[model samples]
Target: MNMALLPSMVAIPLGIAFFTYLLARKSSILADILGNLATFSILVISILLIKTRGVYVIGGWNPPIGINWVLDGLSNLVLVVVALISFAATIFSTRYMEQYTARYKYYSLFLLMVGGMNGVILTGDLFNLFVFLEVASVASYALVAFGCNHEELEASFKYLVLSSIGSTLVLFGVAFVYGATGYLNMASIGGIMATGNQNTILTVAAVLFIVGFCIKAALVPFHPWLPDAHPSAPAPISAMLSGVLIKALGVYALFRILFNVIGLNQLYGTLLIVLGLLSMTVGVFLAVGQWDFKRLLAYHSISQMGYVILGVGLGGYILATGGSSSVAALAILGGIFHLANHAVFKSLLFLSSGSIEYSTGTRQLKEMGGLISIMPVTRTTCSIASLSIAGVPPFNGFWSKLLIVIAAIQAGFHAVAGITILVSFITLISFLKVLRYAFLGELPEKLKNIKESPALMGVAQAILALFCIGMGLLLLPGPREFLLEPAVNALIQGVEYARIVLSGS
Candidate 1:
């Protein structure tokens, strides 16, 4: 629980990443072993720090001056989610990456992305967050094009151009924040902004931050690149991009700054709601028509993220307008809970998609049939994931979506609540198309000899599948307090985050 261990969350992965690339260049097995071990280590550290909170000031220099890493309820939650998905992806990649030439290169980039995400989660300063964002972003750009095929290269190029614009906007936001408050540390700037001091520069910075993160998160209207990138990359990378990368570098960063640093206002809250509604409606409507398997999931990723944004936006609006604190807390809780739930189920879905393509050599749903007979393990796991994402009962997704609905209704947003349910229904219908075409009906002659995915791939899917089934238990009082309440309390603290960071307690 030592706060000092916080740095290791970022350090271990970065160190292992370079070591893996160098030492395992000729040995894919060594790369696989090193990659899994690194992610598993970070996962363990994340769990141990679940009950811990403090700041690690670098080189004995105090904050407002020194660069620091923070361990708190919110950061801990994100770190755990990132570590969990990274670990699963590494395990899945052992067999999955054999389709590629240099497996070690994949692991190296993969761990670098993991390290960058961890840094983004743990950093207490805006500049460092931007730095880590680039680390992750640049690595992802290369990864999308790793296959060296025309399709992969084109997708990676488009992703690169759009993502570069986002990064530039984020950098400009950072510069503006520093110019406005003369501090790069988040808690420091937040403390200054908490007072009645207001200025036009900060407002512009806020706008830039919103747009930048919207692009990174692949929210609607700003989500041109994800459809191509997710389907082009290797499946494990696809899972990472949808499951945790966007959350860590996009939604989580945006909200932390809006709620904690700039201090949410009625205007900002309304903007978030509008964006959320747009993303939810547009993403799903487009998704329901997709025949390419991973492409469908990619669009769904945009829609599902809208649920997170809507829940949190509703809560932020309530707080900004001086509505009931309890209702706001519930709404935010639903957002964060769904954030965690999506990490598990969506990752399972993408990994499951990988399993199918690995066996059958195609991603088109109409080209697959009666996979249930040839690939029982994949069918069961994929079915569980599909059900979870569609908000079916007893799955993690159902509980979180239900909480968002109840919270929306309680907050007097009946229209919003109705739309939420409607979207879930639409989501269900889309997945039904997947199940009907891919798992049921007549067995396609080309797929008759296809087998279930390799055992390691199945194990990876099973790990996330168990989480999908059991994560609803997170709503229990004890677990909620242990895992979620602390995060809520952290965001609820708002400007008080400065005092905690400055005190290093």
Candidate 2:
């Protein structure tokens, strides 16, 4: 519960990144061990802090001026997801990354990404949030091209240019907010906006913020870069990008700013729903015909995020319009639950794709067949992940998707619910194609001798797959109250975000 633990969530990985890139560069093994150890340590810290809360001022500075790290239910949840996924990726990378040269630099960048996400989750100042967002974004651009091949370089370059534009726009929004409010701390700016005195400048700044985040999150109109970047990164880095990066930097940031800081209203909520609908419909249709395993999963990332956006946006709408409290809560619970589940299953799917590429040296589904006979673990885990993402019963995805659908129907958005159900059906069909071509069809003669993935790869993947199945338990009354309720309470609390952090109680 000590506030001191919060900074280490970012500090430990950053320190490891520095050390690994310098003195540990001579030995890939040392860098690998150090990177995984740092992630694991942060994982333990994040787990311990799930029940903890408070605010810590950096440099003994007070709020409204000094930088503060806010720890609440929502941030705690995000930190855990970031640490857990980063740990699994590092473990998988231990063996899979051996193919690449300069692996020390890879681990360094990997850790740097972890540190940045942690910083983004915990920072309470708008300027610090932007700084951390750029940190994570820059590291990811480098990682997408880590292989240094033509495709990887091209993809990373596209990702960098587009992401740079998004970042510049975000910085302009931050500057505008500061200029309008004379405050860079989230709570102070929020408190000012809550006074109902927000002017045209603030409104324009909010539009810029949404524009920047939507691009970062890869919502449909701004989603062109993700298909390339997600598939182009090294598998573990791909896992980080698809699993939590978009959610952390995009969805979560959007909710915190729009809901808690700028204050969500009818206009913002309606825009979110429209965007979510487009992303869900468009992402799945494009995914259905993809032959590349990672690329298919990349498109699904956009589709899956639509569910999260819809749920949370619905929640914001209900609150804005004075709808039922329980309905709003249900919608947000769906959003947060789906966000957590996707981080697990999506990472597993990507890791499985990586394993296939590792053993067979290809990512195209048409070139892979009867993997079940050669790589049972990869095949089995991939099946579990595919099923989970497709919303098959008793799997993690089913529960979250069900919650969102039920919430939509109860809120009288019958059309939205229908669209959701249709999306699930299409998602199932898409994954079935992946399973049929990649794992179930006739054994290709070229892949007759393919072997299972490395032990570490299997272990890391199994960790995610197990969570994919067991994740439904978090919805139970017991775990739900403990882990999820606090987060739901935070979002529903809205302007109370300022009071909680400002009081530091």
lDDT of 2 by residue, 1-505 (tens): 4677888999999999999999777888898889989999999999988888998899899978899989888898888988899999999999999989998899899998889989989989999999999999999999999999999999999999988888888899999999998999999887887788658898898899998999899999899999999999999999999999999999988888888888888888888888889999999999999999999999999999999999999888988999998999999999999999999999999999999999999999999888878899998999999999999999999999999999999999999999999999999999999999988879888888878889999999999999998999999899988789998888988877888889883
What are the lDDT scores of the predictions, listed in order?
A: 0.92, 0.92
Best by lDDT: 1
Q: Relative to the unseen true structure, what is the C-alpha lDDT of residue 414 in candidate 1, on a scale of 0 to 100?
A: 98
TM-score for candidate 1, residues paired by index: 0.99
Segments of candidate 1 deviating more than 4 angstroms: none
lDDT of 1 at 488: 79
Error of 2 at 98 (Å): 0.8
